[model samples]
Target chain A: MTTRILTPEELALLSLVQDELVPSYGDLPPAGTLGAALTVDAYLAEQPRLRRPVLTTLRAIEVRAGKAPFAELDAGRRVEVLRKVENADPESFSELVKQTYNAYYTRPDIQASLGIDNPPQPLGFELPAFDESRLSRVRAMGKLWRDD
Target chain B: MAAPELDSDVLIVGSGASGAAAAWSLSRGGLRVTCLEQGRWVDPSEYAHSRPDYELARQTSFAKDPNVRGWAADYPINNSGTPIYPLMVNAVGGSTVHWSGHFPRMRPSDFRVRTLDGVADDWPFTYWDLEPYYDLNDSMVGVSGLAGDPANPPRSPRQTPPLAFDAGCEAYLRGLENLGWHWWPCDNALISEPFGENRSPCNCCGPCDIGCPIGAMSSAHVTYWPKALAQGVQLITHARVEQITVDHAGQATGALYYDDHGVRRSHTAGVVVMAANGVGTPRLLLNSTSARFPNGLANNSGVVGAYLMFHPVAFVSGVFEEVVNGQRGPIGGLMNCQEFYETDLARGFVRGFELQLSRSVGPLSVANGGILGHPVPWGSEHHEALRSRYAHTMTTSVMLEDLPEPENRVTLDPELTDAHGIPAPRVEYRAGENTQRMLEFSIARARELFEAAGAVEILVDPLVQESGWHLMGTCRMGDDPERSVINGWGQAHECSNLFVIDGSTFTTSAAVNPTSTIQAVALRCADWLGRNYRDVAA
Candidate 1:
């Protein structure tokens, strides 16, 4: 039961928030389309310390919606609920947003889209060799050290 | 039951920068040296940058702040009043294992603060007195820089070429050039040319602070400890010294420590060296209460943990329209403008600051939130925000000179303690008025530079809380025993055979980083101890 952390309805609500946080634009799909919420769900299970804060933010928005589940709220109402939660408890709001992005961007597909397939190591980026000619003008000034 | 106590000719309390240098110097003079280090020796292969999840490790195991990355070896620090958080790593190399490797020597006037600015007291020794030692350390560490920098005195030519300013850094150089301000290529411990078989030339990994993926960066573990070990110096890892044990006659006998398996043990020596840095050194001294020295070990002057200093940092970043190399190359070794480093009372401050080009966020950082003042929207604008920020921004970190103030100090915290139940150190500090004034002046100057460099938007932060890397001046050295904890040549004023070779013994904190100066001073002190140990020990 601990392994299967998030309930189906809770996962659906989280997915809806993730979708709104990163909506589909151009040819790309929204975060929900890439199962970013599922990724976050797995992350939350891995880091149980984050479970309370993540749930607090989600529940705050859900409770802000009168009678309707956050997953069933209209897009405009969803934004209003999110904004209220953000205004009321910004730390928790920011926490969920940060974790969502971490889950999203670390995906293989997202890395491909960002044009950085490999990590920064093993094959680091190429930088232009520093040209010493840049020193000619500055070198002419000579020993500006304050010795007096 | 306690373990059998060991004895040595010389006992060093830490295996970090100063300890490594002291060990190597003393062993070369044919002394038996044994170093007790609290932390494990981190494998280079296990460094953060070697894995794909590099940035993640920085938030966890490899974090500079001991508080955030609560490894077993780390001690808690209470940074309540000060804006800057104490950032350090508890490993064989200490914080140098995770440093950005920006090595700059202090200017000549730095040692004569009272004579120059009428503020803090002068150091017991002058920069010229230490110049030869600095050159020796530079040669031993394999620094990369161009000599003949107008801002500092002439020196031996750098071993390798400096990391060239990339397309993005050129923007700032052009801005400074247009403004006619003095700028220079920064000296760095990070090597640009290949040296020994173990180390290779830089791979241009952007996150060098997370422990260099390649051995290009100079750290004590890679640079000095190898030579010291080759000279037959004994390094005992996971030996956390809790107290500097003193003999019945009030001389430093050795240390009492917890071994790897948590067994209490003692090691006696003819001479004792304290290289555990500003916070740790003072903490150990204060905790070592006794019949002869109830106040602390060699602390009869009551200045064991006084005059703590940190280069209070303020970050100024700018957003530009054109995207250049975002996360490539060495961050700290690129370029620096020291136009305002020397004291100029007319600028509304007695001392001044240095503006060094710093890091921009990686893709994950941008995705989290754009910048300090700028927030990236998550919806339709997320990609655009990430693209605009990652690699497209330039940050100039203003390092303000922290004058020595008795109030800005590290004291034993009343409530907090480390894992082994030793009372942790708490920092009671506030940015002095002079430092604040320098920040305002530097901010305006950075804004002008950014505008001149054609930045579309400028971001300003008054203080960077996580920028406290240069730790110094908790157990200062001076000529008078009444006015200082230690004296010239880093010998404790109260205990004859006791020595302090770490940043704790600094008299003043310059605006520049302290790694190179600390090593140079350590070399000088080790040389003195090697020559005069017979008199002191007797």
Candidate 2:
């Protein structure tokens, strides 16, 4: 049986952060829409060392949001609250950002949006033809190393 | 209480680059050769690049650092004493399974560093002595490179045409031309086109570091091991060698090892060759203490694990406007500049470094702190940065030459042990002043090259601690028995029947990658042993 590491409220807070970080840009979906927060949760569950710090950082951000829950706050207010948390603990915030990006960028939908069809796999990409002309100057230089 | 014993004419430990080459060369001479590899053969079907979540392999199965990868066969090393953590693979092909296939030969000047630059000790043999072997190994591995590289001395032609250059390579070439510096297509072990029966052409999968599935990359498993196996060389996988047993006369008799099921076993051989790499070789020797040699098995000179060296690396990345499509080709550098490879007294360093231009890493790799200077920002700025820099960045890796320091040695950890209850190898290293100066100069040169290429943003990462792949000089070769463990022929000075054919026997850490040279030296060692096998066996 699998244990859930993130609380429902904490997962909601993380989803809010993910949406703000990688929001919808025209046709592109936000990171939350792609389920990046759930991926991050799965990753943190396996990595016991990172779970405590990540959960603590999210809690601090929740407190900084004030008045309303972090998930209910407006985008502008959420950004302001995140800015305060980032300034206070840049290392933890940076680590969270890296984790979020790692989860978001590896999604199949995101990969499709980036035009990378399929994993670079059983059939790899074709490269440009080799050009011998590029070696003209190097050949003309002719044996630059000293023998002695 | 007795271990089961097997017998062979020759016992080779570790089936990596050097061991596999030696096995192929010696097995062809009609001698019964047996090789013991700690790790099992990698199945081509299980290669990470074929899966949907291939990018995550960099942190899991394909990680450069073994501790991070956490394979069962891997042993932990105490890296507290050294600034850089030593990295190696334990599979049959060893680190070659995860290498980028950059095959560069050490220059003629690299052999005589003491005579030329007065910094490191000179190798007993010269570059000319190993030229034929180098050519032979190149032919066997099927190198894909152009002939007539001006930076290197004249050599035999490569087996195939060089890999095609992408836009990133062209930009780097233009930058080198603008500075009037020497640059050339890198000699890669990856086959550009199908030539030999053993392998096929590379498909530009861009993940050569995680074991090529199509047998395009020249790993030992696809190159030498196949030939060795065909020649009837017995290969035992998942066999962790514990120590080399010696006779009373101080000659190598056999080796004690742990089998796949952790059962104790032994292999008796006329000649025992230790090709277990720099760190593993030293650890084995240090642990093989007996009544005759209290300090170690071959420690008469008390230098069994002394004079360790590694190539200190510096990285620089440049952001260009044009999309370079960095994910299409080999992950190794597309081009290399060796203009500053020779020593210059004016540069405040005795030796120099090589500048290789690399394309941007995969999307996940870059997002997880693989970028050099700045952290990836959050919010809308994060998406903007990724869109612009995803396929547009070019990196330059500066591989600096490191001199041997006696204090920078490998010793057995007093408390730490592997799964087999053998003491783990402990690394003690600190970069010398010369290496530090060379790194600074190389980073500056990389920045200049980026500027010359007309990059908008230049990022520099100087002297990362995790870049310790080139292991050498632990059991260095020399004529002086009092100071060196092995001789010119890779025969141990204390034990005539014992030989070490690997990066461990290197006298100096050359500026270039050491894989090709290690194979060349192993081939040369096999040649010497094959010629004198009758007398050695007697």
Candidate 3:
């Protein structure tokens, strides 16, 4: 609910990593295009406990890339750095991955494109009513359990 | 911090499935009833399913794990070194607030586990003793199912028709038919038709576990609590129970709990019922120590925190080549196969597993790898992987019936404490040899079912953390007062006025969802109390 929990520098670094994580695919833009970094930053403000670990992860990845803030690193070099960070501290890295994906995919436009009517409430989907015919074969073999 | 005493004839702690049922029955029977729930009431409008950030909300606000969500009402549970982390909510409806409403009654043989399978203690009462209660609870909860399946005993017709099967469930049903195995459209605690004034009919919203805003799912708040409140049952919300106080005779007087304003208060009731599920019940019992009962109230049998059981689940997801909508219908299960439900000596295990069909996957779940434990790879293959697994995958929670072991238990953590400084429950559990073997056997069989359904590829995460929803056997019930903590009627062996009407009193953990059975047991206990409160109270 708070505005701009992350610094511009931090947001820049996070967007680069988010882009690297999901990249771009066809007409669907990458995670960065869908504002994953901003969403994650806003979420971190809500869940204050997660903010430190996420920032620590970003700084660690920056250190791993050497002389670069991980944002300036080439695509090839960035992948190497991310893999190394993932191996070194899996919990933080995995949490970052989880949050990134969560932010990217739950966006209304993304869900709409994925054939989901957004906000699956008030009005929901429909399917066939329960048909008794489906149980014809199984019911034919009467009563498998021995007890009443 | 002591506050004024409140008036009540019966005080029940925890307003989950069992607690709600007990409240309704006891209050209807004309007894003064009051329930203390640690968490506040949740309005249907606040449910995550209605928001665009629904999946993210599941990780944060609506998380099943208390440690992850870290709300004020929740007490920290130390689940260190346990493969299956316990998942529960502390709100008015308790865990049922975010439940799948997958209602499966324990079979007749489940009660006589020791006599038939030659392991674990048999329940003091038989399935026949509890059958009427089960039928009553089913009617009250408005269970949706088809009768005469032949896998279990014939029963009264279900209240409503079975939930509609999605494409993924239909595919699984086809697999069962192809293999000539026994299968049934699952019984769910869901209202297919509009039964309650508050709840809407099922529209197959596909996110019942995310907290149903429409109230089609039979959560206790919507189903039992409404009637219980209407019948003049006084339910106290945000009342975190700290200890179960006792009289000089070691008989139950009432409970001392921290009220909403963090003020200590005492409520005196003639009878006290511990309806705070398996883990929560034991934690409270162990934390409550007094001069009359050194080891803890009603814990003289030394089985107060023993024989803890969790149906260790092995999650298997199948990716089919054919079109299947995994994101429609009830996500918990539309079909469940009990082919290996009965214990066969040849299977190399004393107990078996029930393969529950679940195919609901959201975009966020798919991107984050869901329960299958394989995050869709990033970069070039990300979109393709997402599309392939989105609606085309179906899952089965291979629920293994973990036999009760004395070593597997819930103990009070000396170092860890809740906000009120009450000791937190430390769970010490490892899947025993029997459960491990059963998993190996059941996982292989589950693969066959998926294969028959034309799954191009299959994924298995042998054990998932969120599968620890079924908590039982921390305070066992039996005929022998020396062996069990509670008696057949769920009355504490040492304390006549104290009753345990939750999964904690289960003698054995059956290989099915225990909500239906838990409520049935609660109903039976409340019915007994209503008819004989004077005798029991004396």
* TM-scores for every candidate against the unseen true structure: 0.96, 0.95, 0.97
Model 1 over residues B1-538: C-alpha lDDT tens digits?
0112436778999988899999999999888789999998888678756444566665667777888888788889998867788888788888888888989999998999888888888999999999999999988888988888888998888888887568887888778888888888889998888865588888777778788767788888888999999999999998988998887899888899999899999988888999998889999999998998888888877888888898888778877888755567776677888888887778998867789876565676667643354557776677777777776888888887898888888888999998788899998888888888888899999888889888887888878878888889988989988768888799999898889999998898988989999999999999999988777762
Stretches > 4 Å off in candidate 2 = A1-4, A45-53, A59-68, A72-77, A80-94, B1-6, B371-374
- Write down the C-alpha DockQ for each prediction: 0.64, 0.68, 0.70
- Docking quality class, candidate 1: medium
In terms of DockQ, the best-performing candidate is 3
Output the lDDT of residue B248, model 2: 85
Q: Which candidate would rank higher by TM-score, 1 or 3?
A: 3
Pitting candidate 1 against candidate 2, the one with the higher DockQ is 2
lDDT per residue as tens, model 3, B229-297 = 999999999999999999889988889999988999998888899999999999899877889788888
Interface RMSD, in order shown: 1.9, 1.5, 1.6
Q: How far is candidate 3 from the true structure (C-alpha RMSD, Å)?
A: 2.4
Q: TM for chain B in all models?
A: 0.97, 0.97, 0.98
Ranking by TM-score: 3, 1, 2
lDDT of 1: 0.82
- True-structure RMSD, every candidate: 2.6, 2.7, 2.4
Arrange candidates, best lDDT first.
Answer: 3, 2, 1
**lDDT for each of the candidates?**
0.82, 0.85, 0.86
